[model samples]
Target: MDKKYSNKGLKIIAAEIQGSSKQAIGKIIEENNVGFTVTKGAQGPVSIAGIPHAVAFGADGKLIFKGHPASEEFKDVVREALRDVKVVKENLGGLVALGDVIEQRTWTNSEGVKMVAAVTKIDVDKVVFRLQKNGKIVPYPISKLSEEDQKLIKGMIEDE
Candidate 1:
């Protein structure tokens, strides 16, 4: 017998509000016909999956929205809710492509550390890489680097 598998894309929408609490954001989400799950975690310079982009509302409202990062509609809804708030900053990452199973390969980094990463998706010539470094699927910008660097990185991944 033979079996087949399919690939499904994961889409997430997230938000970060400056002056409101998670509970407050929940209420707003409910009112806006959107759903969200909030947890206590660190909001930092790095893009953490499931964490929303922070937006500040008034002097006491801070909220964040997390969903499909590639969904423009989801982003629009979050933007509308935050229409009255001041946007401090927008930190978001794009989609990545984890190549086919047959071509999936693992490579080592500069420190002689073994790493597994896959090409999840590509955006505007930027290749999104899923680095299995910290047990999390983190994305890195491969298109911004120099041509030589890009080739080097691609070679490293393709090396058996």
Candidate 2:
């Protein structure tokens, strides 16, 4: 275990299950010169799949293994967890979402007052859109918009 995961910033715990001896674990740690925080035995034995059970946790707090630590599956899982740890150390931020979707709808309200807006949302009784003049959600009632615009808005409501 020391040779495989030395200097790899992994919080490994060789826990004792079923009230096992600590000498064996201690001997192994001493021989390997393993730099671990806690090599002590648990207060009470944990009964999972019997005594010796190894569990690996990734940097993202996800489980990697819960069985024998010396198995092939454990090695593969540890490698993957190491990769995740490395990636997390290098923080990732999302890229810009520029002009993904924009719609220019010409809306005319009551008293023949016309206005051009970027339609953001169309609801059952109102159209919530960004006014072209100033970027703000303008809640224009469906009853106030022009007849043709009302038909389109009603279609949107029916589609939902």
Candidate 3:
């Protein structure tokens, strides 16, 4: 699936939250030749009631599907979501092109705490951070961020 949709901008991340040891997980990944990122944590904002559950997020960072991966509906939803997605080259560092989707990013605050989130909404004095950890939307004053972060936000706003 990764090879099939990678060029179409489908990013898959598997979060292993069953408390498996890192070494054991590494061995399993090596043994199976898994190709995507597998983090050891709970998926933020998504609730899974059982194993093999799947969730799909569209290019706009919106939840679009939740169900078993083997279900037919999952594939249909994924295909539809990628229908208008622009291809993105992996690991190439540059600004997102006009009409390109904004993926998750790391942000730091004035106290030096950091989190991985996407900028959901940016107001004049505040920004909404959608945390990838617990699926929480945090409202933060733009002034409380580090100088570098503030500049980053400014750049994003300028691009708009």
Question: Number of the top candidate by lDDT?
Answer: 3
lDDT per residue for candidate 1 within 57-138, as digits (tens), equals 2223343444454577555654555355332211212222334221224644434445576655444444555655654544
Per residue, candidate 2 scores C-alpha lDDT tens digits across 29-121 of: 689786664455554333357445777766556665678767899888888766533211111122111220125556777678888776566
Q: In model 1, state the lDDT of residue 25.
A: 72
> What would you estimate as the lDDT of candidate 3?
0.78
Query: Which regions in candidate 1 have their CA more than 4 angstroms from the true location?
Result: 1-8, 35-97, 100-160
1-160: candidate 3 lDDT, tens digit per residue:
7668877756788888889999988998999999988888874898897887889987667899998888899999998887876665454343343243335678788999998877677889998877789978788899999999898777767866
- List per-prediction Cα lDDT, in the order shown: 0.44, 0.60, 0.78
The regions of model 2 sitting more than 4 angstroms off are 1-6, 18-38, 43-47, 87-160
Pairs clashing in candidate 3? 45-134, 45-135
Q: Estimate each model's TM-score.
A: 0.24, 0.39, 0.55
